[model samples]
Target: MEHNLLQAFTTRKHTVLTSSKIDPTGATSTGSLKVKDNISTQGSQEKLGKSGEEEKNLKSNKKLEMRAKDTGSFNIKMNPLNKDSLDKPDENGREEKSTESSKKMQTKKSETGEGHDNSSFEAHQETQGAKGHHGNQTTTAKIQQTTAFISKQDNKRQANQTQIGRSGSNVMLDVRRRDCSKTKCQYVIWQCHHQCMGWGDRLRGIISVYAFAILTGREYRISHTFPCNLKEFFHGNKTLWDEKVITAEHATKRNIKLFGFLPTFGSWVLQSSNLSETFPEDIITFRTNNDIIPYLRFNKNFTKTIEKAFSMPIDDFHYVTLFRRLFHELFSPNKQFEEKFQKYYQLLKPSNDSTLVCAQIRLQFIKVSGMKNVFKFLQETIKRVGKSKLLVSTDAENVRSAAKTLFPEQLVDIEGPLGHVDKPGSGCRDMEKALTDFLMLSKCDILIHSPSGFGQQAAMLKYPYKDVYQINYAGVITNLTIPIFKLENLYEELGPLGGEQPPSLPSRYIKNPQKYFT
Candidate 1:
């Protein structure tokens, strides 16, 4: 009986070991059979004491085999069936492998100079997470790096689009056309009816009318037929302003009320209750040589309107900012004028490191020629600025000849007969030269000019107002503190013109502004 019980216990122990090795789900049943076999074997050993030692040794061997099989089964159940899992080592080895894989991917990405797609990267991250904790961390870092690269690329594309838009590319032109098509646009036509004014004067009137048009929400147009069509030299920057939009019926007296001078007109508009109500005409034409910016600055209503239209604060509203915006928006050189400007500008060879000084000598408007003093100032300025180029723009041929002869090394000017745009018999070629000089003068580092509106307007084009000196009638050089757009400065310099005094709000209007507006 003892022999039979021992043999049966051995057979049951072998079965439990085989089942546990083959299937992890048999662990519970294998454990129960082991317990039962141990009880039976111990009983058989005690009943047959002669083979007790052998039985004890066999039981010990069985416990070792069962433990080994159980551990193997648990491992097979816990681990996933994947190549990475099958080859994985201990915790330290997995961490090292994760680090190595991350470095390899980064190096490959850098070598190829390419970014991973977002969807593919996300899938990689999920696979890495399933592999190990260290791999998940590495994937997180890669995601941040790739995301930043994508963001940078997006920003670059946006910047390029913005630059294209500002250059008046076809995209922006189409957008403007769409906007105009959506509404019945109103216009303020600035007509030059044989006005005895120079280019500077006409520009001032045009910009003034443009400002009014902005306040009244109307498009600004130009009709200058005295010397030549304005389009012969200049065209619009973002828009076209010519007679094509106007017809014979639209040019009647009713739509052509003229505002003779800017100061008086500005005063009348400011004091009036409402501009639209007072001037009911659809197309009000202005023909003046003076700017209404200084007058507009004083009117609270006008300032508010301007600020809103430009999306700027009133404090930021100044001569330089305002004039630059208007000039660039309204005027662009035509093909002929642009070619001439480029030729002269190239002759100057303006450099970023080296300074280029512009001297505008207008003998037509100023009473005294301060030629000697002007030369002296130029010499001092050149010496101060070290390596420099000097560009001279003037209406007189003798002045140009003198400058070229005196400063041959530094002097640069267009070779042509100078002529005023407003004067009759000034051919289109000469007028184009004048326009080219005006634009080139604005592109200088320093400016030395005479007390002429042409010089003043040219100087206004330079942003942040560079070192500018004005030579008076007595040939005395003075540094202009404020731009010519300032009311006090303009009034002091130009004095009362067009038989109109400096703009002043009426006392009644000043006391009760609401009463006048209402």
Candidate 2:
């Protein structure tokens, strides 16, 4: 009976050993029987009293332990089988088991779930890790896109801010439409004729009329078609001053021309207490060379109204500031003028380090002695500024030749016949050249010019009004005060009280003076 029992036990052990399979980590393929098979095989070997077989089993167990350590696999110590040794759910709701059964159970779970027996749980874990990495990569790409968009918006905002800051008070000029029709709208048209006036005088009249329109709540337009169309050189920026909008019939019936500095109208038309009442006509046209900005500035009521209209303080409306704002608000260089202007500006090759001194020598107006003094003043200015380029703009060809002869290396001037804008002989190209010269003078750092309205207007348009020295008829260089807009300067030619004469008509006229009126 004992021999029979020993043989049966040996047969059972042999069957268990043949049925079990060991993985590379030494865990059995059948998870449920892994610990059980190891214990049963050891017990059967001891019972048979086979010392060599026992030694062989010990050697194999040692080899598995070494292999587990080398492969960084979890080594299972011999332990009794229990209910907890079976696969149980972990915190993540995934199946987990004891060290001895973990690999085998995970393998079986993967085979059952995915129908891929060759693909182990470790391979699935690697795929999940790769997926997590890709997810992180996707998140990183979105973050970079968001950052780039924000940076682009920031740069755009900065550019807009720079433009606004550079424009100064000009940005505050009312661009909103007045919403009025041709007949119904009260208009202040700057009428230009074939008179003895230049571009500077025309600009002054336009600025004055525009300011008058602003103060009295009227639409401003330009009717300059004598020598050439005003649209040839300049175009309207925010407000279009197209003369075609005004009909010939309307101009004939409703237009009232007011000339400044004359005995009849004098300055009373501009100084009238009630312009709307004084001139009840639909269109009030101005044909004057006198700058009425100072007169407008002297009128406290007018200044207050302008300040209120523009929503700016009275003090902030300096002479230069107001002139610049009016000039830019009314006109922008047309494409043709702009192209020529850019061509000359590029010729200068202006940069932060380069200093350009503009010298305007009007031979038509300035005498020979004055011209000499002007050149002397320019030489002194160039010497003072140090390493300067002299840009010469003049109405006479002789002045250009003289400047080139004087400063061959440092002189810069456009090669063109200088022509007056108001002259009948001047063509479109001449007008374009004149406008280009005016704009280029404004770009210079320092201005040494003769006593000419052209030079004065250019200086007024200059931003940050740098060193400006004007040479009078006697050839004396006077340092003109900047922001040329001052109450005293406005009242200089006019009396201390702001005007020489009062309005000819009363504030309220009982009868319309039809003979004198439009």
Superposed Cα deviation of residue 124, candidate 1 (Å)? 82
Candidate 2 per-residue lDDT over residues 35-124, each given as its tens digit: 111112111111111123223533554565454334433332222332111122233432222333422221122211222221111111
Collision pairs in model 1: none
Quality of model 1 by C-alpha lDDT:
0.45
Q: Could you estimate the TM-score for every candidate? A: 0.56, 0.58
TM-score, predicted candidate 2 vs. hidden true structure: 0.58
Worst 10 residues of 2 by lDDT: 137-146
What candidate 1 gets wrong by more than 4 Å, as runs, is: 1-183, 246-264, 314-321, 364-369, 383-386, 485-518
Give per-residue CA lDDT, model 1, range 387-484, as digits (tens): 67888887765566656655667887676667566556665665567666777666666777755667777776654353555554434444543343
Clashes, model 1 = 0
Backbone clashes, each candidate: 0, 1
Q: Among all windows of ten consecutive residues in candidate 1, which has the lowest summed lDDT?
A: 138-147
Question: What lDDT does candidate 2 reach at residue 23?
Answer: 24
